[model samples]
Target: MSWRRALKDTARSGIAVEKKRLEPLIAVRGAAGLAIVIALSLWLFGPAAAASSAFGAFQAAIATFQRSWRPRPELAIASGTSLAVSTFLGYLTISKEPLFLALLVVWAFAAGMSWAAGPTIGLIASSNVAIMLVTVTLPTSVAQAAGHAAMMIVGGLVQAALIVLFPVRRWGAHRDALADALAAEADYARRLRHDPVASFDPQPLMEARNAAAVTPRQARRRPAELHGARGIAERIRPVLASLADPAMGVPAEGPARDRVRELLASAAALLDAAAHAIRHGEPVSTPPAALATFRTPDTGSILTGAPYRAMTRLNTLLQDVVETAGGAPQESALQGGAPKGRGELRDQPQPTRTRPRTAPHHPPRRRPTFLALIPKALKAMRSELHRGSPITRHATRVSAVAATGYILGTWLPLGHGYWAPLTSVMVMRPDFSQTYSRAVARLAGTVIGVAVATGVVQAATPGTLQSGTLAVASAALMYLLMRTGQFATQACIAAYVVFLLGMGGEEWTQTVPERVLLTLMGGFLAMLAYAVYPAWETPRLRTRLADWLAAQGPYAAAVFGSYADPSASNAPDVRGALLTARTARAAWHAAVARATAEPVRHRGLSRTAADDAEDALAQLGRVAMLLEAHLPERGATPVPPAARFADALRESTHKGAKAIRERRVPTWDAVREALDAWETEDTDKVLRNTATLVLDTLTELSEALDTAVPPMTLDGTAPEKPDGPRNPKDSATR
Candidate 1:
């Protein structure tokens, strides 16, 4: 990308506001917590103490707004505690500029390194750095600062208590995640009606899976309707894909294909209805025509053979989804006693739709409890401490910028030296686009926010009470507009900070010019820091791609191994491998997105190769998913030949990954040879067919990942001739 294009893109991203629904009630809950803390502080302490204390509630509220899976109260408490510690430590060094500056650098580095843990931690940590600036400069004794820090902890507890007592749309995030997954499937099914090979993004399903992994406390209170639905949705995806693909089940154009299209449309409507019902906790109200379309779908002659069976299986699963959405009848009603309104299935008279659903693919995987995950998070941070890691690079860059911005802010005669480093700390991120874009957004927002508040304060010269009131209003707006855009939220934040300073006895007229100028200097410093010491993703595309390829091998092998020995089936093991592969694939996708925005050369993978490799790998994963949907029963006869193929696949892909990293054309000789050997022996037809599909997809993956500079070997020797393709689409009917 050119510098002009990069700048334009970042500007547009910085300016864009999401068209999402305004979550006013949720914001009000957070603001109400802020309001309580402010009133209490003003009454008990003074305007200056109130200024220092309000940030605790303010930050605690912001933590609740993060899209985290942890409990809200936990998030609030953790954020507040982190801020209190930073505030106390920051105050101890305020009398000495050199000491505070060194501490700022170390703090900024830790904040940047926290990204390896997760975005939530990283965001809160970064805010702590920026908040540390203002808190340290409040001209208070160490004892007084400790009191203020204690007050911050109280703010957190108060916020947590409010959250526990006045819950708004409880389990609402989980509901939306599940609903979004269902809605995505609905859209995919509809698209398949016209384009059978149409692509689907699995992010929503991944998020749903994440949301479903609840703590022990959460599991007990979980809504009954949400229990089994996500598993059903996961299973539905591959079945939908396998049923629609022309090569797998349906004909290109015929009466049967038209029947398939009808089934697709019906499935879409049913899914959409289920999604809506689940999202709003309402009874399922599917269209009558959609229900009728499932009538005799398989029994009719319109679909036959595999397509027919797939259609039948789909109708059965659709019933399960609808039933789950509409919910079961009350226990009392089921026993022919008194009726209850909740948990009643609507439109439940279809006696023919009674086909049994398979048990959920596997029990939901257990996510670690919040307390238990800390050690793991710390381990991850430790891993990222090396020089090669982007997190480390980002940490180094941000820390340097913070120290430099602070010195320059103070030396340049700005009375509020903290504003510069604070701006730099808040705007800088781990990647190029975010760091640049947020710099632009934050500066613009601060200008507008500070100017508006400055005008009001200068005009009216509001006293302590009025200034506190105005600050609270700004904080409320900050909460309300946080998600709409960075620009809007930062605007409110700037105005809020202005009112806070006014409450703290700072003169409005003297601060306006310093605020805007220092903010600009800070933003410029952040952007410059990134440009000088960049960590571009373009160079690591090959490494990311290889990592994904390596992960995919084990996932496919696990599925194949299960078929080879049904009695020793490792469903959980396969699930774990599948999750690892998904993480690797998601990492590759994210790397590519970030790399594309960078003004750096593509180091290892060209654009065309990356796209092709991505598609081929997605197809491979989809094939594996389809096979997983129909694993053999525990006592079923095993396909012995599959075990050999699985071993060969596992070996070939691992070597191929090395070849990929060495910039050589990856060869799949082992895979091809194994396929030839398998063809010599007769096997169970379905197992043979699925195995061939897997092998063929891997071959496509090999061809899609080509490099032109030179051919090299994993051991630094010359390469051998690439293996010829033996398409499995031929062994079976195409």
Candidate 2:
């Protein structure tokens, strides 16, 4: 390649890598806070005092940014309180060796259990352990320790102040999430218009939904608007999927085809408009007259076919979309107006309903006081803890390793033995994959950081000002690359540690080898702890997959049941079932990804089987979406076979779930009988064709599930084939 072309390619790759890093603004805020705190300490105190205070500020700053997504006040309070308690404990035990070792064990266990609450809280707990380890080793008086703790709190407060002064824009993350969902829906519609049988991936939409779910509700401009938009997006997916199926109805031509295309284009445009409004924090207007020409096509004419019928259904959904976008209650839109009987179809079409001319006044909501918030927060934390949870197991492992590491550190001929336990706490995670990966990264990063620190220290010893500057720079670089992956984060953290220690008047050359060796010992202990009693995703794969399969039964039943009784309200129930199934499926996919990253020997499901199962589930979701789309429109004659097919599907799915749970082979006799009955029944041609597709997809899903696991008895013991258990290599190939 030409030099210019190669250079351009290299630059593009670098930009991509940087983009994977955590938000740069967060890093800048952390660095700025640390800089201010360090500068103040240096100005007010001598070099030695400044170094001590800087240590406290650095720890507090790290804790503040550790969980940046939380509300500003909460972040500040949590970080400050956690650091103070940890620092005080460290100081208290400085003169008591046995107590210090005992507390280290207890603290490690507590930090690990904190993971049950969530990743953010767990990070805070782990960081506190690190702070305590570092602080206890420092030679300082009681008053000095107290003062240092206060400085750390000040550093956290500075970060909180910056958050309030320069807040993220209203509806920033929420708007983006909502817009992503809408855009994905619009793209799906566009694809269906061109390729009726095209396969579309639902992962993007699923991810967008997850993103929206996590967004802080208080940050949104209109919380209700987001809810309404998400509802519309979910309803639109199945409709587009059904329309894309060639078996749905007769193909339209000439003016009929053009009209159908026009409707699809209109649906896409409406979604685009809704997304645009969300992005700009404005109101969404109703679609123009061209998009509202659903009733223009005569239902009694020869041109009335599957395309026309599909377009008619599309019109109803679009009306709901427009009404929802205009701030009409989602309940009213979702119910699709009053149900229309066949007799009502003969009359002239009424104008579509829009939002009311005047809004109803409502009293303002009362915000909760701090006193009330305390109980709620406690209740939430309590709910997160349970027996046999990942958190509990992790806590047990972490505490054991920490206690062992501490004892070993004391006995080993190494200075600053606290580094052993500190490294163990840093490397351990709730999951095996994360813990192993972190251990590796921590070891490698420490080696590189030590080498670099040695060179810098030999070249020139930094003064108080120089150390402070280096600390700020390293802190920024560490956080900036933290989110990229474990390796980048560990590397930055290692470098940050070097500068941070220098500020404490430590000679880098002496500290470097000791730090590296102690880190290695801790990392090894963490890995061993996990290996002895792993919380591996592979072992949980079966349960997760079974949950997803089981959820599909209720979801399919709800969708099909809606068609049997159009006048009855089941929309909410159906939506709930669909959401549950989606969540389970997402969880299963995540588990598979984690399993892939783990060792081959530890994996339960082979890569090939996992991939096949994932594909089958995706196809199953699409089929379910198609069935939902083909639900009888208001006033349309109910197809008797539709209910029968739905019942069979529900039964088959339940049976499949039972098989998975019981660890036995799934029997397809009932499903096959349903298919036979479906073929014999006197059903509408369209409904029969759709039923065929559903049965075929279910059969495929069952076969995929069966292949995904080994043949096992009712007691869940795998029985080897006559040739004995298949080789691991063969399982992967199969």
Candidate 3:
């Protein structure tokens, strides 16, 4: 594709993308808040004072919309305070170039460190840097600086008040996340019913899980319901994969197939209903007929095989959904009458099941005060000091690049030198893909915005009032499009910058070209810095994958050990292990996504190998979840074979992780032997079946490791070595 076509395509995609529902409201508030501040300043202080005071309003508006979600009151207060301090410091150093330069450098370092806290705080800190730079440029007295700072604080306060008065539904994001997960599950089921071999993208579900994971503690009004919905969605994924297996003999046609399709449709509808209820704060209505379709599978039919197993899993999911809807599952809904020979599939343990019934009577958590948040902010900054952390590396890179841009801006003859460093700071993101993409978009948007602004200024020759109006509109547009992605945000930001600069009595024709060139220079510097000393995700993909693989062992051991020796004391440890493994898995997925976004040549693993590894990890997670779900509540099972299988699985996973780390082949002999021995040993049907599932998943995992592990050296820099013969069986059993 030509560059023009590609750019057009990108613009179309960005414009068409859907954003969070509350985003438009936040954008409007941001614009209105700043406009109010500017209007008040103009009325009280006149044109000259209003010109300087508008900078304060601009900073406040930027701070207001910097985060993906609305800030809690504590966070908003912290942000306003930071802006005030930075603005005061800027005014203090306005007369001393050396002091100003030193302060900027120091603040850049601090801003970089703030990234460890989270994206929201990182953006706030970065905005502070930008505000300080802009504020220092305007000539002002100490009194004027204080007044401006107060005005900015007022702007932020207005935003916070609006948030309190017309608060967003606390559960909106969570409800949407759960709804998306279930929708993905429903799609996968539909695909399985038609073409078993068809590929299903797991990205949507992963994104949903990540979103759900970040639910604020205060927003979790219906914790049990949220947990139940999420659990059901996760468990259904593996069951769908099992049904897709050819050996399962799921009928290609007949009553069994029709029944399966109906069950999937009902599940999807139920999920949609639950999502609507949660989003709107209404009650969920369950249809009795829909529940009945999945309650009993026809005996002596093709449903007797894998189809029946899938139905049982579906029935379990239905029960969870019903509970999440604040209704008890009828006995019929709970009991899926399978064929006589088939054993019951156990329901996974709900994470919130242990909560007391009268928990609502407990006092609510105290809101975070500003003093309390100070320690948290400091702790977050401190945690990023480690050399190996991704955020630390990113912060260091951003600081170096921004400092270089600043030095060049000072030394060069450009009229608007600050634009160079500002561009560098804005574009230098942590990951290679985002950094590169933002650089391109920033440059492109600057060019387009300059041209458009120049045409408007020359044609209309707008005075102060018109320029101010245009600036407000542009600011509102910037905030509205900000969360969509970099491209849309850059376009709007470029226009906002153009209108904002014009309001200060700068000629648009003279300033636009200089601004564009300086922005381009800054963007190029940022991209070049990353390219030269890149922290590309591809290089660390193996390490991240290995870490995830390693975590699985402890997670499995903790869960299966509980089955062998069920104890109330072990519950916390098991839960912690599960959480650890889940976190590691999320990290690995994020790594893979980042790697994919980078240039193809930088990717160490082939697409096929990466996909296989991801699928294997996902399957293993499901099996582990299944094992965790079925653990006996109180008494010890003392199943020797089950214990042996768990040990062997743990050992094999550990060995595989080691091999990947050391760039050597892994042996799975002990794992295969343990599986074979466990199969032969006398055991209960439930234990036997679960163990068989584990072994099967392990074999697939071993195969994926075989494909993925051989492609890179210890440092993940070199090509694959030519090892002797490639045999799947031998490699897996070694």
Which scores better on lDDT, 1 or 3?
1
Residue-level lDDT of model 2, residues 642-724, one tens digit each, is 56667777777777777765555455565556657768867665556544555555555555555655566666776332221
| Stretches of candidate 1 exceeding 4 Å from the true structure | 297-305, 329-369, 684-690, 711-733
Model 1, span 1-734: residue lDDT tens: 88889989998899778876778887888888888887898888777678888898999999999988778998899888889999999899878888988889899999999999999999999999999899877736888898888888888888999999999888899899999999999999999888877778888999999898987778667776677788778778877877787756567888778878888898899899889988998887777677667664233455544455466567667777777776343211112211111222222221133212233334555667768978988899999999899999999988998999889888887688778889999998899999998989998899899989988998999998899889889988988889898999999999999998898888886677898999999999999988999999999998888899899988888888888898985787788888899899989999999998998888657898888788777767877776775666677678888889889889988987887887877777777788788888988666666677776766666666644335555467765554544443343346
- Cα-lDDT of candidate 1: 0.81
lDDT of 3 by residue, 60-175 (tens): 55665543333454455566667778878878986887777777787877887787766777878877776566655654588888876776676667656765676655556656
Query: Candidates' lDDT values, in order?
Result: 0.81, 0.64, 0.64
Inter-residue clash pairs, candidate 1 = none
Q: Which residue segments of model 2 deviate by more than 4 Å?
A: 1-18, 21-23, 41-73, 168-170, 190-227, 250-389, 601-605, 630-652, 668-689, 706-734
Pick by lDDT: which candidate is best?
1
Q: Flag clash pairs in model 3.
A: none
Error of 2 at 499 (Å): 2.2
